[model samples]
Target: MNTKAEQTKGASAGDIGKLTLAAVILVAVIVAYTWLGNGNVPQPVRLIGLLVGLVVALAIGAFTGPGRRVRNYIAESQFEMRKVVWPTREETIKTTAIIIAVTIVLSLLLGLIDLILKSVILDWLLKLG
Candidate 1:
């Protein structure tokens, strides 16, 4: 029995063509935006053209197989995210307090040891040279 999940089929020629069309639409949108921005086109008209171009590009992309797969992946990710067990406010506060306390204690201990070593090695031993 094949226990693995069925893999998605490879992209067909039609799917490749659809993806190429989507890319072309997006590129055209970018070119239009730049051309409009450089010219004396009105702001509202330019904005409308940009919006229309984006919608057309997205629509084309949505018709492609890869786009459908991407949408499915995003949906699955969101579903998995909803299953996470997030920490409560009280738990977070307690954890933060413990971390801060340990850090302070460790820093004090290390500082004291460093001071003792400096005094012994530099002050006392070096003075005998």
Candidate 2:
């Protein structure tokens, strides 16, 4: 229930301790995964360990101030998305076709200009030299 001003302020000792513990767990998990590759552990189990570690770290961090802001931002983004007017399939296809046509035409125009400049340089400038 903290305001933006309070959240933006420096983290308290408890938050820092929680964040550090989360980081340590993350590093331990990664090291364990790497070590497991050299032992008899299966790849799937190692991957699961990594995933579980990530989730645990994330959960721990979610109690901090920044995590609440991120959650709020995501919720607001989802709400705003509902108000967006997305293009229909036919509109998208037509827009895509127009873009492709414009690109092709511009490329051909550029190629023609390049060829003309090359011809002028080789035939006229070289003969003068």
Candidate 3:
């Protein structure tokens, strides 16, 4: 099985062209939608045209080399995710509670330190004046 890094090697000229065409198709769809909207076209027609353009762009993209690589990567990620040892609900709750408690305690400690420093600095300034 090829690793994710190995699968993402440099794209060929054909792949670049396909990807560019897909982008252009999507941009053209946006332009068309704007133009139609400005020309008072019916909402339904505009929506249909937008949807059709999106589908065409996606289809073109899906046929490109990078798209296939992305699909493969997603499959690999799913496989890896399945192998993960997910925590139980109880464990998750306990971990969350610990994190919250630690954060609260740290914030209080920092606040107290800030208060003390502010009072000390103010007193020193008063003495200088």
Best by TM-score: 2
Candidate 3 wrongly placed segments (more than 4 Å): 1-9, 42-45
Cα-based RMSD of the predictions, in order? 4.6, 2.8, 2.7
lDDT of 1 by residue, 17-129 (tens): 98888889888988988888988999889888888988988888887888887887788888888989999999999999999999999999999999999999999999999
Q: Which candidate leads the pack in lDDT?
A: 2
Could you estimate the TM-score for every candidate?
A: 0.65, 0.89, 0.80
Model 3 lDDT tens row, 10-94: 8888988988998999999999999888887999999999999999988888888888877877988998889899999999999
For model 3, name the residue pairs that clash.
none
lDDT of 2 at 35: 93
Off by over 4 Å in 2: 1-7
Global lDDT scores for all candidate models: 0.88, 0.90, 0.89
What would the per-residue lDDT of candidate 2 be over residues 38-72, giving only the tens digit for each residue?
Answer: 99999999999999999999999888876776787
Error of 1 at 19 (Å): 0.7
